[model samples]
Target: MTEYKFSDRAYTKMIFHAAKYPHLAINGVLLAEKGAKSNSVVIVDAIPLFHQCLYVTPMVEIALMQVDAYAERENLVIAGYYAACENFYDNTLDKVPAAKIADKIQENFKGACFAIIDNKLVTLEQEEVALKVFSCNDGGRWSKSNYSLQNSKSTLEAVSVLLKRGAMKDVVDFDNHLDNPKHDWTNELLNKDLKQIMAMY
Candidate 1:
């Protein structure tokens, strides 16, 4: 059993992508570094895939290659995959698409995890931070576990810049675009965060 630490920036990106496409389930890769002394992983960042289907398509495979190359340059490993279910109450990550994606991730990185964003808490007001992480064992069985979050000023800066540039909307690629009316909730949430960040300056 390894402990996982989710940096503020990494969590922000995960939540942002989830919020950005509340109607569609979005998936992405988690980048992390091995900790000293103990068997632990510190998630540094997330690379989201706004365009994904029920199956991992050729495009998704190609995108993964790019993510791998990027990770190499950054000196980080592909730790796992994170996804948000379209329905807020659906916390099941062992289903078709998630299970299939996690298998691919495990094939690449041994002890890879699959995290599901807690959309119910995220979309509505809640006390707990919105994320649930699951790891695949040697027997290829998935198990739920707890993770940590460490806030970083650098992450806040990065998220703020992306918001200022409207990067969320622009970064969506390949499949369906995020033109759904439900995006209003996401947009408002992001705007509120951006404003709070601006107020600090």
Candidate 2:
């Protein structure tokens, strides 16, 4: 059983991406480095891919290529995929959009995990991480998997503050970048701000 540890940057960005477009389905890739322990993956950041046309391929391919190149330069791997369903009640694996992308990620990285944003938990008052992780089995079935959040308590608190401050608007996705090349989907500024805010909690 491989363990997935999500850094505050990764977790908060995923939540922010979904929150930025509450009525649409959102998807992204997770970047990670091998953890100190065997069978552990530490997800350091998340690259938001799309909030529109979740089933499209051309855009997805282009985004993946760019993200792959960026990950390589950063010494990270695309370790996982994440999605936030448009329907508030659809948090199950079957409801995960563009699941083929996740399968492709697993094909490349056997330890790849899929994370679904739990809409009900995506609130300022929510105390727990709003993600449900799933690992694919040999039979190609996705089952719930356990994951840990780096600085769980503070991460939640920081996210709450960020939401209240309407910081989610600062999050950019591939769609935004496509509309305006200058919109940096890397979210470097947001990551830095999150780190500083999280430290205070």
Q: Pick the candidate with the highest TM-score.
A: 2
Q: Using Cα atoms with residue i matched to residue i, what is each candidate's TM-score against the true structure?
A: 0.72, 0.96
Task: Give lDDT tens digits, candidate 1, residues 109-153.
Answer: 775777888777663332466778877766778888667766544
Our tally of clashes for model 1 stands at 0
Candidate no. 2 TM-score:
0.96
Clashing pairs in 2: none
Candidate 2 CA-lDDT value: 0.88
Error of 1 at 172 (Å): 5.1
lDDT of 2 by residue, 1-201 (tens): 768899999998999999999999999999887443426888899999999867788999999999999998888889999999899999888877578999999898888899999999999764988999987877887778889999898788889988988888999999999999999888888878887887788
Question: Candidate 1 local accuracy as lDDT?
Answer: 0.65
RMSD of each: 6.8, 1.4
| Worst lDDT 10-window in candidate 1 | 177-186
The candidate 2 region of ten consecutive residues with least summed lDDT is 33-42
